[model samples]
Target: MQTTFTPAQLENPHTAHSEQIIRKCVHCGFCTATCPTYVTLGNELDSPRGRIYLIKEMLENDRPADAKTVTHIDRCLSCLACMTTCPSGVNYMHLVDHARAHIARTYRRPFMDRMIRQVLAMTLPYPARFRASLTMARLGRPLAPLFAAIKPLKPFAAMLRLAPSHVPAKAAINDPAVHAAEGPRQKRVALLTGCAQSVLDPKINEATVRLLNRLGVEVVVPKGEGCCGALVHHMGQEDEALGFARRNVDAWMRVADEDGLDAILITASGCGTTIKDYGHMLRLDPAYAEKAAKVSALARDVTEFLAELELPLPVNKTDLLVAYHSACSMQHGQKITRAPKVLLAQAGFTVRDVPEGHLCCGSAGTYNILQPEIAATLRDRKVRNIESTAPQAIATGNIGCMTQIGSATQIPILHTVELLDWAFGGEKPASLAGVEPRVEPALAAAE
Candidate 1:
């Protein structure tokens, strides 16, 4: 893992940082066993160690990204499972992120690839546009089979196939305002009403707000806050992603300066990971550097925040066994392993962990749409692991994982907060209507 960057190359901050990350690799290959691509594709180049070598060669030689390097790098899910598995503590997430940004600068993608990436960049971060596109995608969905036959149109086919048949109505919780605590406000927090999640399943944020309010936490959806920049950030759109970070920083910092926030809560674990990294992501910006660090310090996943609260007994506990599918971002990226499952168990459901829980569900942001074939492979693998648990339903903290797994399985997928909300006396999740919980022995005997 020795690096050979010249003095001039070392002068660039990003190069210097990436070189530091590259030097941490001990070439153990522990990552290969956990990498979804390497596990599925069996290509050395598709593994983190393989991709690290490719990244090192491209950066050290100061050459444009070759087809081989781009292919391997693009296939990466950025699940950060390698970071979790590495004995040497390699920061694969930052290294791969730097590699992606470099690819954006130097690699020229195919026309169709460029078009689809551009369309996703422009559309997904904006809720209104995303909703409209999904509506149009409904018409195009009928043509997915035709598109799948054409190689270049496969991403479109993936997009069409992934779009929900009915777009959810925009929830009122999305309005920029504050929901006061029921009694006294012990803590005030800003909720990240994310771009895709807001449009895809508004109930996540809704459930988060309701549950937090009942627990005496004031939830505010700041007016200027938008996407967490994760969607485009993973695509190597560095400038666009940074733009999103800056806007959110300004919006949330305003609340921090005025009312003082205890936490910036995020229901989507993918966004939570990126939002929590705002410190490192904006460290070079002199003006935003300190503020971004403060913002990142305040960021918390809803489950992480909830695990701290003193809970009353569940008002509507069920005997349902929940197969908790930990999102890659939640478990690997943020290292939040136990909060959601513990919260579910405390809320009176039997929580079971999925086998191979360290692997990604292949829903790393827009990965499913961009790399449909490989995505499908990993997703089916994930669905199989989830189903073996034989739970009444599946629970996860990410909207992306929910969508990806729900597409492949018959089990109802719901956000963890939704189940917690229902248990805490809010309305039951509509997805659970037909799922019958097992009767306890005593109750069955009494009946």
Candidate 2:
């Protein structure tokens, strides 16, 4: 692959960065076999190599995004599986992100597409507003059929269809400032109570606190921490995303400066990937650049941190069989492939891998809502492979994957931490409340 950016265009920071990424590609079509859209739509334009060419053309010409380029780029899930598969080590994530930001600047979308994108940008990154909007979703759900029939408003129909009919009570919002370690403190770390995960499944936070406290790790919920900006960042809302990034850096830096943090533990793998990249995202900001790099250094996924702690093996735990669905962000984006499954096995559960583990489950942030038809195709394909493992429950590290996979399967879904938490000393998950807890005989004898 070749880029023809003029010397003047190459002087621009974004163009310079994209040029570096583009030059790494060797025109290998290995990426096509792993790309979800290419596999489903069978369009060369839908694959990474095709999109790279489109991006290279758009950047080199320094012109507005055309309909063909926008269509192919918008369909991309940004799963980063191609990054994992590429032997050349091309940085597709940053390249795609830069292309999206360019699209946001130059593409003039239709009225409905603009409105839908606006609604998502304004609401999803803010939890209280999102909850309020969800409250009104019932009124819109009835109109889903009508919206779906419209040419440009089908994503709006998908949004209404995915909205939960009943919002849970607010008691479990998990707003406590700090949870003290149950015993002598071994480490003190801040926990990211992110936007959507807190609203969608607050219990994941609770379980995290319990497991950390039991392990003698004090947990601090930084007051000003909010969304990780991943939801908006991937949408090409560059300034808004950077704004959220800086605010969170300020919030978390204050805590680290005052008390000291060994690690910043995150449960949501999608947020973890973005949080870990705060360094690269803010590299050009002179003021935030150093602080963002420091924050990224301290960030760690819960499973990553737990693996460091070398958690004690589970005692008297049932021999539960679990199909571990690795989130695309976890396995591919962050390259955290084995820690979660290893933790599951160490916690006394039989962990099995899904067949197409490298593929995205169609829950790349807002990808599902924005591209419902293609998203559904990938989701069904992912579910079939997961179900073939014959497991009693599914375990994952991402709330988005849990929501997407849960919609398609009746199998009990647990956050990897939730299962690990309960297996040690916490209460059994409500879904498994009736089942008696017992240790595997082989595990018991070994212990």
Q: Candidate 2, residues 229-254: lDDT per residue as tens digits?
A: 99989999989999999988998899
Residue lDDT tens for model 1, 1-447? 998999999999999999999999999999999999999999999999999999999999999998889999999999999999899989999999999999999999999999999999999999999999999999888899999999999999999999999999878889899999999889999999999999999989888899999999999899999999999999999999999999999999999988899999999999999999999999999999999999999999999999988988999966699999999999998999998988899889999999998988888899999999999988998999999988899999999999999999989999999999999989888889888788878999999
Point out where model 1 deviates above 4 Å: 440-447
Per-model TM values vs. the true structure: 0.98, 0.96
Which residue pairs of candidate 1 clash? none
Best by lDDT: 1
Best by TM-score: 1
Candidate 2 clashes: the total is 0
Clashes of each: 0, 0
Worst 10 residues of 1 by lDDT: 432-441
